[model samples]
Target: MSEDTETVSVHGREFQRTSLDEGVYYAPVAFDDREESRLTAQHEIVSRIFGDGLFSPRIPVGEPEAILECGYGGGDWAVQCADEFEDCEGMRVRRLSSRPMSRQMDRPENLDLVAHNLNDPLRDPEIFKANHYDLIHSRFVFPGIKSGRWNGYIRDMRLLLRPGGWVQIMEYLPIIQSHNGRLTDQNAVRRWWQEYQGAMADMDRDPRIGRRLKRLLLDNRYRDVEVDIVQLHIGDWSKNETQASIGRDSVEMIGDLLESLGLWPFTSKLGWTAARFEDLMQEVRAELQNVELNLYIEL
Candidate 1:
């Protein structure tokens, strides 16, 4: 189906509204300063968690001749990666709901940015040549891809990769867990997460896509699939200095995410009043600060 895109304002935030039959690009987050900051913090946290690596694939694909990063939020990962692989040509594909194009300036000379809806196929054969890219990286893009279209999405990635090319995808599990059994159904964090998951499911997006990535890749005949899971603490709960630092960042990021990510979904999709959503977020934020609960999220 053809898509007509327009900028939309919701609750003092901006989102890209697209007219599509299948309803791809369902991300509820705004494309404003808060969202950009959140993406930046998330990138730093994930990089530290993974030992500052740009990409993760055990079987080395050697020096990538060309790289493609889908859902290049805030363009942090793409810019850093371009610097790491300075000689390689890189393309950053931003979703329709990403920040303004003007914000993407000052990128590396070898890095090119393109605005595209990932749910649809990359139609520009001349630009997106068949089996041309050596490495394809995507992170936190599952929300923009419909659940039923994962197979088609994987097929498209395969078509874009060279024979030995590697594709790295990183996603976060929607559920929140506790190291101890302190977290219960009555907890505000758990309640908010449940609502968030329901909203995603209602929009035909897979909230559990992180856990399903390995199976999805293997089923698509992608050999040697590797799964890496990192647990992110919600507060300064860890005794280790590095982990405590990460947890502090996580608390701040998650607090911001409570509003940025949940504002639209909870209010729009779940039929919640704006005031009610804000009240719940307050409680969730407070709950996240409790080191005693030992709450954490898996990525």
Candidate 2:
């Protein structure tokens, strides 16, 4: 890892420059493979963008021979890309609080995991020089940005990307799922979405960050960029067995994120009392118990 990294603190969570591994993000006590599957799903979206040819898009002379990923929340995508595009360098950002680099670099591979607080503007705001990088990728980065320093997200990407270099921002549209393709209470779901959308608008994080990416690329001076709203169905919710299991697990994941950052102290206006929230969550879980599968975004 590079020694020239910076650190910052916001919303009580500290950000540091460090590399990542499975054990850092995933709890050592958890036995499930959900995180593993989530990483696979993200790569599938990238694969769809790459089409059937070699990983590298035809590039003009003097372009950097590497790709950069802004917030490598999970390192799996970089690992997969390294396996696929052996010649391209895959870049990733690491939290400052993570484990030592010596342990992570023990495995010899082409991928370079760096230690850098990605949102620090003064520290080479533009990661790669102008016209550098064949492609730049970032995903699931907004939740972290809510703490502060939002502009750094766009500015860094714009400054780092080489002219004509492709930049792809794949983000999830925040949505609370319902089993059986029917909202448990249409009013409740609608209310949740309206308020959620309004919050995102205020934060400048587009709800359709995935679909709006084309416009973002254009606005940021990227040429020939395209965005797709890819909706993935995890399971067939109509089948009772599947939906119930997913519903239970999905609610648990949201609870985990909320509690992880100590965020529950701020959401009282939503009418979510401890008991009421559990009841509602259990309702969704029960709804899933009767259904076979479910669909949701990663946000």
Candidate 3:
């Protein structure tokens, strides 16, 4: 381990800086219209977990000196949160949105949004120092962690939090994006997502995010650690146009992501064909409307 790096554990999940690899990274597609939709979709997921505008009776609420928001994709929620808490908002930065959203999120007074790549050398420890932020919030950062990157990521987050300050993280469990309302057959579609998981394992990756967080947090002696698991049903896509539309968009994004990430470089691995992939995703879109994936963890 480097002199600057530190070990962090949560719920028994141990992370070392040496475990964070360069390969466990993602650069979002530049300015796709889909970005807004996906952000909205993610907000729907997170808003459910955190509750709209941070008022949740089920969760602990505190007035934070500074708030650290990891993965500020569109800064939609961050800006909204900043707008609400006059003294709470701090810099919300990400690698890709670092440039564009940096300019945009700066419109608000309390918000100091920046485009910072986490993989780069962190120049300012004060910006992410320990015992600093009263609230550290992260959503769906697991995918970005790749395989070996959780240690560095977790350490970075732990440093940002003030002692006894709350750190909230929410992640999707596998069974990615439920779809298809029914009619033709469900067996084959289930197998596809199962194959997807195998492919993730094949790539030395883990998609289940919330699974390890509880263990990591408790192991680190974070007090009052709580995890709430919620399953959200998007509605039956075949019956509801609005739900179906969202599911279709999700399916489309998945297909694009599959192509972009080389999800099936070996055609045999996924049984991938351009037409077959699209068709299979459309089938998924139908199922996702009424389906719900695991929304585990609020640690």
* Candidate whose lDDT is highest: 1
Candidate 3: residue 161 lDDT (0-100)? 68
Alpha-carbon runs more than 4 Å astray in model 1: 1-6, 19-23, 26-31, 57-61, 89-105
Backbone clashes counted, model 1: 0
Q: Estimate each model's TM-score.
A: 0.89, 0.57, 0.67
Overall lDDT per candidate, in order of appearance: 0.74, 0.44, 0.50
Q: Whole-model lDDT, candidate 1?
A: 0.74
Give the residue spans of candidate 2 off by over 4 A: 1-64, 88-108, 122-127, 146-152, 177-181, 184-212, 237-280, 288-299
* lDDT by residue (tens digit), candidate 2, 134-252: 66766665543433354445656677665666665666665646434665444343344565555445543445555545655566565655545544333344345543344344444
Tens-digit lDDT track of model 1 for 1-299: 11232546677765666522335543333246667778789889988887776766374757777888777767777778777777654443323323333243357777776666677776566457678888888888777788887888788888888888888888878577899889889998889888998898898888788888888898888987878798898888888888888998899787776677677778878999988988998898898888998888888
10 residues in a row with least lDDT, candidate 1: 93-102
At residue 203, candidate 2 shows an lDDT of 41
Name the regions of candidate 3 deviating beyond 4 angstroms: 1-30, 48-51, 55-59, 87-107, 116-126, 176-189, 236-273, 290-299
lDDT of 3 by residue, 169-189 (tens): 776664543332333325434
Q: Rank the candidates by TM-score, best first.
A: 1, 3, 2
Note each model's CA RMSD in angstroms. 3.1, 7.9, 9.2
Which residue pairs clash within candidate 1?
none
Lowest lDDT sum, 10 consecutive residues, model 2, at 22-31
